[model samples]
Target: MAATPHPAHRFLTMKAAGVTLAALVIILFAGLRFVHLEADFPPGVSGSGDLYTDEGAYSSAAVRWVTTGQWRLEGDFNPAVNLPVYPLIQAVTFKALGLSLGHARLTSVILYLLLMAAVWALARRWAGPVTALIALLVMAVNFNAFAFSRLALLEVPMTLFVVLGLLAAARGGATGTVLAAAAFLLALLTKTAAGFALPVILLVLLWRPEPLTRRLAQAGLFCALTGLGLLAYYFVLVRGHLPDYQTYFMTNVLLRTQGGLWDLGRALVRIIWYGRQFDPVLYPLALLGAAGVLVVGGKLRRHPLFWISVVWIAAYLATLATQNYAPARFYLVLAAPVGLLLGLMIEHLARSGRRGAAGLLAGVVILALAVSGGRAVDYLRHPQYSWASMMRELHGLVRQDGRENPVILGHFANSLSLGTGLLSLNDHYTWKSSLPARLERYRPDYYVTLGGIEAPIRSVLERYGTVEPVRTWDVFHNYYTGEPVALYRLTRKSPLEASRP
Candidate 1:
């Protein structure tokens, strides 16, 4: 049996609890960040030295922007690959903190912190203080958020803007509407994929308590203006850049969404499994809450917060399934909604006076925090910093070959280019059939292959030079693989012999 407290005292206690939860979130994320600051990669790649692929491209772009005062891709002005918001943020960080991987990643860390703060605000708005606290706790320790926050990538920032817009929409006023419009525009500038959120936002506005016709008209005007502004901005920026606006829009948007049906199915499965992986107890509870609204659409169905989460999950899933590729970080958009749903579900259960069920939920939360926190601690402090040595050796080998600014080609060309200060080309994507011709055209001095070379690619290289080991690599520290990395220099062959292949 529990004792009921005086109303005044209970209010004070709740306020104290909220403050404590806020502090805990700050300490947890900030501490986790610094604890794993040297997690696996070296300083130049990511602050925590993780082998996140996009970090290299984004950071390299930032370095170029900061030093040369031009936003370029692969040493040329190309706006096709990424939007300007993230690179612009990184460039500002470079100016203030000096150009280093740690400083570049610091920008992401800060954005993630802001993201957590936004989650707390949105959760508090939908649910009470207790759910808000739990939501913050879950986000603070969840491995994906912890890990991705330390990398210089755009996912966290994109999610941040999206959540901010959602929060503004939830507030429901003239000011909130204007803020939502601005936030959504910023979200699009961060990542064009954010356009997927438009459907969700439209759904939200329709569900608003205001009269249907007025709300729809207002939402329509606002969205139209926002889209026009974004187009005008992009039009101004694409001037004199390679892969201009039309080409970028067609390839990244139109072409990218055409296939990958299998990928969509797989992503749906992975999102469910990984959602559980993040928090076994809470995610299932979230699903239960979702089902509750579907089955018992009383007030919950009409609630603005409920519909917001519903739309977010549906829109993001559809977007993920339709996209050509799905990375783990792309699933991050689901985290906040899951948190809110969990809180709502738990609140619903508690209100039904199922004390036993509520007790079990508490147990699950405790178990999840302890289990997830323990795993994160082990991964962070582990002494698998050997990847730094491997990259250093590879950099040395490139320098030893007496080829400054040499054209180098590999699968992870962006990471290698960033690490080695040499021209690196990625063969992972795009016209594989033309790889040989491109190699001849680029005329790379060194070819790097992870694990070993395949026959087709090897045959092309063998036409020009024989394979020789640069150095034997024992392990790759990032993915924790023991595969040996091989580097080969394409010694010149006679023009006739080279043409024989």
Candidate 2:
């Protein structure tokens, strides 16, 4: 019989193995993330209508901040509708380097990788190296995470900060509390949704088995300092520049919660279901992991961090589910914890003499990574991937038509058109109603249309001038589909202006 390996040697071997596995996962994730860093915006921004609006607004703000030192919300840049942290960061980045949409998006990608590292570290602490590696692998290729990571939006940063906050809280160090507090404040500034799970974190700290008085006092001080700092920052620097923050808070937060508890339950279900968009393969494993948590809830009850994760996931799902609309992106916060739970399940299986479990987990992760990677590649190569490019081409058409300044009128198209530096005659006006009158009033030098023509666009274009055929662009979601996207220039004879001419 072979001599039994020493326990020390066995531990060393396992550690080495874990390191190797984690490195491999990181390499795989990086290749996928950076594959087309300079390409257009990610998939959702292309074909999906509403998704691009936010990205367009944020990118415009970034450009404004870089070109002019003003951070105030411009007509095209809707600060009132969005949280400031991510855009603020983008502005800072733009200030540091010239504005590059690709560079700005690359910043988000880097944050996502940092977030992955954090997840791996946190999971490693709770589970083991193998479980941590597996968890990172699962999150690396999760479609929603991958997609958002590539976009220049607040969601990815907010998700990163939330994960950082949770990781710090789990470590239970004094410095960790400070890190957690800072991250929490940043998340709140990034998105209103940050507030939903915050209370649960406070509750966890208050109820932890540690000295209740000390923990409560620490928590209170953290909140107080954070609140005071934010107050000072806003009042001194960003107060008047921001729209009525209180009004926004009331509408987005308080009023949003007026629905009954049953609404909350339904919302929770929807959030749970939305995870299917990320990866169908991992959903069953995640469910099994959630069941494991439920089965071991009694043991986990003593673990404050565990309860915090549970509460955070629960509260987030509940709040988002109750909302009138549930998008797949809203479920991003669930990715880390769900990945952790799945990692724990895999670990349990591996320990139970099920060697095949590890192989199966690896196989699923590899397959998902390949699928997500392929999707990312397709998005980059497709022309419609870049909203910036579409806007640029549209601007060129207007310029070529000798329309020095055109009154741009449209909805979703306006976002890209205005965002990429096109001049709009009136910010408040869109060609949604009475297009002919509005077109006559504004006397747009050109009319731009996108996402197929509606009556308003067609009527205005026909009334004003000839619609010149532009170019076609491809749009992307999970995959690429070519669509005829045209930018038409409508020219009209100026009455008084031409008389003067």
RMSD of each: 5.0, 5.3
Q: lDDT by residue for model 1 over 367-446, one digit each (tens)?
A: 77667667667777664544445567777877777864577666655555444445555554333565666666667777
Q: Across residues 102-190, which tens digit of lDDT does each residue of candidate 2 receive?
A: 66777778877887887777666556676677667666766667776776666678877877776666555477677778888888778
Q: Candidates' lDDT values, in order?
A: 0.65, 0.61
Residue pairs with colliding backbones in model 2 are 267-321, 267-322
Backbone clashes in model 1 = 1
* Predicted model with the maximum lDDT: 1
Distance from true location, Cα of 282 in model 1, Å: 3.0
Off by more than 4 A, model 1: 1-26, 41-52, 66-70, 73-82, 171-178, 207-209, 237-277, 297-302, 348-356, 418-421, 433-443, 459-467, 474-482, 490-501
TM-score of each prediction: 0.81, 0.77
- lDDT for model 1 comes to 0.65
Pairs of residues at least 3 apart in sequence or in different chains that clash in candidate 1: 41-49
